[model samples]
Every structure is written in structure tokens, then in C-alpha cells.
Target: MDNFLQVLLDGVLNGLVYALVAAGLSLIWGVMDVINFAHGEFLMVGMYVSYWLGFILKIDPLFSWVAAGLFLFILGAVTYKIIIRNSLGKSGMAPLLATFGLSMVLKNFCMNRFTPNFRLLSGTILEGKTLSFGGAIISVPQLVTALFALVVLSLLYWMLKKTRLGWAIQATAMDKEAAELMGIKTENIFLLVFGIGGACVGITGGLMTSYLAVYPEVGGLFSLIAFVVVALGGFGSIPGALLAALLIGLVESFSGFYIAAVVKYVAVFAVYLAVILLRPRGLFGW
Candidate 1:
């Protein structure tokens, strides 16, 4: 029973990381009505930013999160101006294909620049820290990451609910044409949305460096999971995405502990299917 409780606790902590990683995808999907296949690349870019900073600047990943966030925001803004912006208002496949191709370009670019070696950052503040409760050992770094995710979720929620920028974004999402009619600048809104989305995942990527390895293909590992979280949460629902991510994280943790590690993700998807069947709009999509 104690073991079960520990697993439950770990699962809940891990679930919030899923929310952080998927938050950007959910935001981009909600704001632009575009399925950004390249969202993972933004994460990859943020990882590299942290990796290089740690290597060259002697700054830890956690402290370098703001840098990663700003860098990816610019990257996202440029991407939108160069690719996504042009593809908007066309067939849905336009942005999808554009992002898909952009993703390949970014990946290959990284492969060429950094090679395929897996790099791990050492000596971060959260390194070598753990807590024991009964029979369960808790990782401090993971716990901290989860707390950071919670902060990010709260900040996003506040921005969307309490600010003028939030209103602009909401109005734009509701109807871009209508928003334009009301004197809101749709172009700027798209730019801001993309930038905000990029910053979210970028910070996540940097934060994850405390525990995960950095490699060219690392982003792809979480990319599918991020998409699943977004889908499970409902299209364009930030709160829904956050909740779904936490649920999937718990599902993965519990299944990996009690069932097979190999089928853990399968378990998460099974839950997603069940939940979707029951609530097509998702838990908090409305």
C-alpha cells in the first residue's frame, strides 16, 4: 500500500511535466488553428540553448530558462513570419505540411551542427538530490520540475483570464476576422501567440535538461506524447491540456510501475481513448 501511494505521488509529479511540454502545442493549436508539427523542434532548439549555455557560460539549466524562453520566442516569431504566416488562411494541410518540413529542416540542421551524440548536463542545483518516504524514493529534480510546471500553468491561466493581451488572444481565437473588425491587430496577435507558445516549450526544454539527455532526436520522443496530450485535453483548451497532461503522466507512471515499462505509453493512450469516448470535448475544453 505504501508502494502504491509512492507510485501515485510520482505519477502526479511527472504528469505536470507533460502539461508543460504540451502547453505550447495546445496554445499554438488554439490560437492559430494550425497543427504545428515543428513544435518539437522549438523544444530541441531550447535544449540546445541551455546545453550550450551550460557548456560555455557556466549557467545551470534552471537559471537559464528565461534565456531559453526568449530565444525560442524570437525563433517562433521568425518562423511565423517566414513560414506559418504565409501558410495561414489556406487549406489546413498548408501549415501542417509547412511545419512538418520545417521540423525536418531544424532536425537535420541540428544533426549537422551538434552531431547525434547524447549530451547530459551535470552539476545543476537539483543534481544528486532525493527524498525517501517509507519505501519510496523521490527525486528532487523531478519534484522541482513539476512545481515549475505548475507555475507555468498558473501564469498562463492568469494571462488568458486577467489581461488585455489575453482578451486580444481570446478574441482573435474566437474569430480572427471579427477581431480585426474590432480594431485588434490579427497579425500581431498571431505573432504574440506563436512567440508565447514557443517560450512555453522552450522553458520546458531548458528545465528538462536537469534530468534528461540532449540529443538531436530527443524532441521527437516527446513530440507524439505532446500531441496526444493536446488531443486528450481538447483542441485549443489550455486548462484542458494541462489536466490531460497530468492525467497521462499519472497513467504512464502507474502503468510503468505496476504493468510493463514497455506498455506504459500504451496504457496512457488507452485512457485517452476511454476519456475521449466519454467526453468528446475533453475535461475542461469548454
Candidate 2:
């Protein structure tokens, strides 16, 4: 029973982090209908930003994450103005290809600049700390990351549901022509949405630095899992992302424990396949 509880707790914490990572991708997909193949690179950059800040200034990730988020926000907005804007409304796979190319550029840039070696952060505020409950032991950094993720997600929900900007975002997403007719600047909305999405992943990367190693290729697996979470949760649905993330987290955790660690991801993809096969529209997709 204790072991079961430990696995369950681990799964939930991992799920929350996954949720935060997927939220930005979900928002971008929902609002712009643009699949950002470079989304993972955005995360990689943010991790680097956090790592450099800590290494140079001795600042903790708790504070450096804000800088990472801000940097990624600007990067996202710039990418939109330069690359994505040109591909908008174009026929064929221009938008998709544009992002894919951007992803390649960012990945190789990191490889050349940062090298392929993995870097781990140490001596941060939450490093080497743990909390024990009953028989289960939880890492402090993981707990903080999970709690902060939940808070950020809740705030995002409130922004979308209670703010005028949220209404404008939704309207633009639903029909760009109609939103433009109603005096909503669809272009500005798209820029902001992209920036917000970037910030989401950026913050996630910063938080994860306390516990995970950073590398050029680190985002690849996470990117794939995030794509699954966004599709499974229904594109553009925050609640859906959270639900799907938790489900995947649990499946991965339990399978790694009971089956084989190497095959845990196979179980995750199997569940994703089964769910999509049954409901092609996704759990919450319209």
C-alpha cells in the first residue's frame, strides 16, 4: 500500500509538470490553429536561460524563471512577427513546415552553442530536500514545481474565463474574419497568444531545472509527450490538458513500476491510440 501511494504521488507530480508544459502548446494550437513544431525548442531555450542566470549570477531558479519566461515571451513574439506571420493563411503545409524548420534551427543552434553535454543545476533553494508523508518520500523541488504549476494553470483558467482579453482571444480563434470585423486585432491577438504560450513552456523549463538535466536534445521526448497530451485533452482545452496529463503520468508511472521502465512509454502511446480511436474528436476537442 505504501509503495502504491508513493507511485501515485510521483505520477501526480509528474503529471502536473507535464500539464504546464503542454498548456502553451494547447493554447497556440487552439487559438492560431498553428502547430508549433518549435515549441519544444522554446522550452530548451528557457532552460538554458535559467541555467545561465543561475551559473553566472548565483540566482536561484525561483527567481530566474521569471527572466526565462520574459525572454521566451519576446522570442515567441518575434518568431510570430517574422516567421509565422508570413505563413498565415497560406495554402499547403507552409505553417507546419515553417515551425518545423524553426525547430531544426533552434535545436542545431543549441547543439553548436551549448554542446551536447548535459548540465545539472545544484545548490538551488530546493535542492537536496525532501518531505516525508507516512511511508512516501517526495522531493521538495518536485513538490514546489507541482504546486506552482497548479497555481499557474488556475490563473490561466481565470484569465480566459473572466477577462475581456480572453473573450477577444476566443473570438479570434473561432473566426478570424468575424473577429476582425468586430474591431478585434486578430494579428495582435495571435502575437499575444504565441507569447503567452512561450511563457508557459518557459516557466515550466525553469521550474524543471531544479530537478532535471538540461541538454540540446532534452526537449525531444517531452515535445512528443506534450503533443500527445494536447491531442488527448482536446486542442484548446486547459481542463482537457490537465486531465490527459494526469492520465499519461499515471500510466507511465504504474507501467514503469509493474512492467518495464523501457516499455512505460509504449503503454502511454497505447492508451493514447485507444482513446483517439474511440473518440476521434478527442476527449474535449470540438
Candidate 3:
């Protein structure tokens, strides 16, 4: 029972990070109707930014999060304007292929610049710290990351629920033509949505670099998971993303423990397939 509780807590913590990544992907898809294959590269950029800041500038990893997020936002906006916007109104495959190509380009760029070796940033903040409850142990970094995720999700919820820009985004998502007719600049909204989505992934990058190793191919793994989460949760549903993330996290954790570690991801994939087959519209989609 103690071990089970510990695993559950760990899963929830890990789920929060996945939720952050999925939220960004879902947000972009919801508003712009563009599936950003390069979304994970934005996260990779964030990891690199945090790495450089912590290693070179001697700044704390947490403090450099804002810088990473802003940089990715600008990059996302530019990419939207130059590539995504041009592909709009074309076949769905247009943006898909373009972004897929863009993702490959970014991955190769990182490989050339940073090499394919896995790199890690060592920090004392979360090292060797654990919370114990009834023979269960939880790491400090996991706790901090979970709290950070909560704060970010809360801010996002407030933004989408309260702000004018949020309403614009929502309106645009619901009906782009209607939004344009109502004086909403759909193009500008796309840019903003893309930027915001990138920023969200950037935050995940920063948080993840502290816990995970950095490599050129790292983004691809999470990007795949993000897609599953988005599809499972419903393409554009924030709440659904949160719930699905937690569910995946728990599944991964328990499967790794009770089932073969190598096949744990297979379990996750199986669940994803079952959900999609059973509910084609997703948990909250349509």
C-alpha cells in the first residue's frame, strides 16, 4: 500500500509536466486548427536555453524560465507568420508536411550544433531531497515541478476564462469565419495562440531539463506522447488534457512497476488506442 501510494504521487507529479506540454499542443490545435509538429522543438529550444543560462551565465534554472518562454514565443510567432500562415486554407496536409519538415530541420540543426550526446545540468536544489510519508518517498524536484504546473495551469485557466484575448482566441477557435465577421483579426489571433502555445511548451522544457537528460532526439519522444494526450483528451479541451495526462502518468508508473519496463509504453499506447477506438471524438472533443 505504501509503495502504491508512492507510485501514485510520483505519477501525478510526472503527469503535470506532460499536461503542460499537451496543453500547449491542444491550445494551438484548438485555436489555429494547425497541428504543430514543431511544437516539441520549441520545448527543445527551451531546454537548451535553460542549459546555457545555468551553465554559462550561472543563473538559476527557475529564474531563466521567463527568458526561455519569451524567446520561444517570438520564435513561434515568426514561424506562424512565415510558414503556417502561408499554408492556411490549403489542404490539411500542407501545414502538416511543412511542420513535419520544419521539425526535422530543427532536430538536425540541434544535432549539428549540440551533437547527439545526452547532456544534463546538475543542480543542488532538488538533489538528495525527499519527503517521506508512511514509508513512501517522494523527490523534492517532483514536488516543485508539480506545484509549478499547478500555478501555470491556474494562470492559463484564468487567462482563457477572464481575459479579452482569451475570448478572442476562443471565438476564433469556435468559428474563424464568424470571428472575422465580428472584427476579430484571425491572423493575429493565430499568431498569439501559436506564441502562447510555444511559451507553454518552453516552460515544460525548462522544468524537464532539470530532471531529464538533453539530446537532439529528446523532443521527438515527448512530442509523440503529447499527440496521444491531445487525442485522448480531445483536441482542444484543457480540462481533458489535465485529466488524461494524469491518467497516462499513473498508467506508465504502475505498468513500469508491475509490468516489464520495456513494455510500459506499450501499455500506454494500448490504452490510447482503446480510447480512440471507443470514443473517436475523444473525451471532450466535438
lDDT of 2 by residue, 1-286 (tens): 8889999999999999899999999999999989999988999999999998988898888888899889999999999999999998796588889999999999999999999999998899999999998899999999998888898889888888899999999999899999999999999999999999999999988888888999998889888999999999999999999999999999999998989889899999999999999997778899
Can you tell me which runs of candidate 1 are displaced by over 4 Å?
Answer: none
In lDDT terms, which candidate is top? 2
Model 1 residue 278 distance off true place after TM-score fit, in angstroms: 3.6
Q: Model 2: which ten-residue window has the lowest total lDDT?
A: 87-96
What lDDT is reached at residue 82 by model 1? 95
Model 1, 17-105: lDDT tens digits are: 88888998998898888888988888988999988899889899878888999999998899899999999878869999999999999
Candidate 3 yields a Cα-based lDDT of: 0.84
Provide the overall lDDT of each model, using Cα atoms, as 2-decimal numbers: 0.88, 0.91, 0.84
- Point to the candidate with the largest TM-score: 2
| Model 2 ranges off by over 4 Å | none
Q: Flag clash pairs in model 3.
A: none
What tens-digit string does per-residue lDDT give for candidate 3 at 1-286? 9878988887888888888988889999877778999988888988888778877886656677788888888888888999998898889789988888888998899999999989888864665579997888988766776788778877887888899988988999999899999999988999988888888888778767667778888888788888989999998788888888888898988898878778879988999999999998788888
